[model samples]
Every structure is written in C-alpha cells, then in structure tokens.
Target: MSKNKKLDIDLLVDGLTCIDNYSNDGFVNIPTDKSALHPARYFKELFMSELIKDGVSDEDIVAELDLSDQNFEEFLNEKAMVTSLLAQRLCVVTDMPAAFWLRAQSRFDDFHTRVE
Candidate 1:
C-alpha cells in the first residue's frame, strides 16, 4: 500500500485499539506530541477530491450546508472540528449518515485526546 494509505490504516487501527482500551477502563494515556492525522485534516483531502471529481463548487457546498464562506473555509482548513450539527449538514451534502461523520469525529477526537 501507499505510505499515506498505510498511515491511515494504522491510525484507524490505533483508534479502534484505543476504543477497546477505553471499554476496559475509563482512563486513557495521553501523549504530548500532536498527531498529523486529525480527522478534519483527512476529511479536507477527501472532501476536496470528491468535490473536484464531481465538479462541485465550494460555493455550492456553502449554499447547500447553509454556511458562510468563512465557516466553510475553517472546516476545509481543519481549523474547526465537526460537531453533531455540522455532521447533520454534511449528511445532506455527502449522502452519508450523520452517524458516520459523528463516529469519525469521535474516533479522531479520541485518538487525539489519547495522543495529546
């Protein structure tokens, strides 16, 4: 597999393992160094790729999501984390369930919390 794909898989596995660890105990070990694989960061890449492939405009997304340009930019730049409301808005645009986004954000946040 490609390096980026491998890293993605590794990070996913680590997140799952962390979930298992959490099930066993309420505590998790938090590291100091920040991770490069934040969900928003990954999402930005996939989001842009899909948008380009589908010939969707950023303006279209903003209008569909009922968001301002600055807000959308923040999300695209990974400066804002996905919340339940944002996930719901995304569901309308991506045709994915809100639960999917929620779970992804949850895993990303959990992974980051454990690492930072």
Candidate 2:
C-alpha cells in the first residue's frame, strides 16, 4: 500500500479502537432526556471524543469534511442546523450513516418545537 493509504487505514483502526474502548454497548445510546440538548452537540461530543482520543486535529477533520471553520464551530455550538449535505459529509469522517444524523436532527427539532 502507498504511504498515505496505509496511514489512513491506521488512523481508521485507531479510531475504531477508541470507540471500542469507550462504548459499553456496540451502539450509541441517545439519552432519554432530550431536555436542553441539541443533537449536534450530543453527537459531536461522541464523534469528536473518538477522533480526539486518536489525536486527530479539528482543523484536519474540518478540511476533510469540506467545512469552513466558522461553520463547523457554529454547528458544534448548535447555531447551525445539520442539513442533509452536512450530514452526508459527516458520514465520511464519522463512520456513521447519513440517516443516523438526519434522524437525530429530526428528533431534536421535534423535541424543541414541542417545548416551545
């Protein structure tokens, strides 16, 4: 394998290892109490924790996801909505399905709309 390809595989393995270490169950369990929680923040904590555990940089992940730094920061801060395009882009780095992201966003929106 080429050097970059090998590095990418190694990084992926490291990320998976990090996930295995942190997760009690195989799946990500969304909290039952959705009060005062945005899916972006919730999911970002999960995904970013794994990446950070592997020593991956936010700048690198943002570039890989083709997101502007401001936009990514805003998304994390819940100032920006998770659109279909962003959800799809997120799958590339997060190893999660685009549908999972959209579903989380939908649930979050539903909860907040009801609360309001």
Candidate 3:
C-alpha cells in the first residue's frame, strides 16, 4: 500500500480511539464530535488534502461545492456538520462510495472489539 494509505489508516485508528473515549465519557469537547469517526469525515479530510496537494485551493473547493465563503469556512472549521447533500456531493466529487463512510465506522468498531 502507499504511504498515504497507511497514514489514513493510522488516522482512522486515532479517530476510533477518540470515539471510544467519547462513548465512555459523558461528553467530548473536540472541534468536531465523535462524528469525526465517521467515514465521511476521513474521506473528506483525505480528499481535501489531496485536492490541495494537486493545486486546488480552498476557494476552488468552495466554488465547486457552491458554498458561500462563510459557509465554506464553517465547513472547513468543522463548526458546521456536513449534510447528507454535501456528503453526496463529496462522493460524486471523489468517486468514492457513500457506504464507505458507514463501513469505516463498522470496521473501526469491529477492530476495537477484537483488540480489547
């Protein structure tokens, strides 16, 4: 596998740990909640990084997503949740399956149980 793939997997594992900690505690105070553990978040982060790497600027993504500057800022800051519509747009943009996000969550949980 590529180095980026390994890095993404590691990040996913970290995300899983964060989710577990939140579940055990009453609350989580991260910029985003356990939703970061969602596959969409991972895919979004990676996709955005790749886009930036490929010379796509934040402004470009905002334009492509048809998001207003303020809304796009909120999205980048994780102050606003990604809607299903946005997720669909991302799936189309990245050619990734929406189910991948759900499956990532399931895989993380499964790994957690196996390791514990």
Candidate 4:
C-alpha cells in the first residue's frame, strides 16, 4: 500500500477499534492511546464517512446538526457527543437507523458515567 493509503487506514482503524485495540482478525489490532473509546467519537467517524461518501458538505452537516460554527466545532472536537435531536437528524440524513445511533450514544453515556 502507498504511504498515504496506509495512513488513511490507520486513522480509520483508530476510530473503529476499542481502547483494548486488539481484534482476533489481527489486521485491525493496532493500538491507540485511549483507555475506553468514546462512542461519540466512533459515531462521528461513522457518520462523517457516510456523509463524505455521499458527497455531503460540511456546511450541510452543521446546519443539519442545528449547530452554529462554534458549537459544531466544539461537538466534533469534543468526542462527537450526541443528543436525541442530533441522533434524529443524523439518521434522517444518512439513512442510517436512528435506533442504532441512539444506542451507540446511550452506550457511550453509560460507560462514561460509570467511569465517572
């Protein structure tokens, strides 16, 4: 693989893998610095990938997310933490199941709260 292609895969893998960072498949076993991967981060990557694949623009996402520039920046930079409204909007736009997004958000909240 080309260097740039390998780097892209590494970034994708970083988003998908849990903090544990090992997969039985071995191909995805690269480690990250996180101790517990946040679901919001995972959701952001998943949603963004789909959106990019479909050629959705960043401006569109910020509007769909009902976020001002600062807020949107904070949300993405702050682990993609999602609310119910964001979940619905994301689902509607991406044709992804709302339940799946909500579940992921819930799981993330639950784990973080537990740790706290």
lDDT of each: 0.56, 0.60, 0.52, 0.54
The C-alpha local distance difference test score for the whole of candidate 2 amounts to 0.60
Q: Cα RMSD for candidate 4?
A: 8.0
Task: Tally clashing residue pairs in candidate 3.
Answer: 0
Q: For each candidate in turn, give its C-alpha RMSD to the true structure in angstroms.
A: 8.5, 9.1, 10.6, 8.0
Per-residue lDDT for 1-116 in model 2, tens only?
Answer: 00111101112221232222222322343333434355576546666776777888888778877889998888889988888998888777775666656766776777788878
lDDT by residue (4-59, candidate 4, tens digit) is: 11111244433544434423321222243423345346446755666666777778
Ranking of candidates on lDDT, top first: 2, 1, 4, 3
TM-score of each: 0.62, 0.68, 0.52, 0.56
**lDDT of candidate 3 over 1-116, digit per residue (tens):** 01222222345444344333222222222323233354445655667778778887878777777779998776665455556566565556565444444445455455546668
Model 4 segments beyond 4 Å from truth? 1-39
Residue by residue across 6-75, what tens digits does model 1's lDDT show? 1122333333323222222222222223332454554556454566577777687788878899988887
* Candidate that scores best on lDDT: 2
What value of lDDT does candidate 1 attain over all alpha carbons? 0.56
Off by over 4 Å in 2: 1-36
Cα lDDT, model 4, residue 30: 26
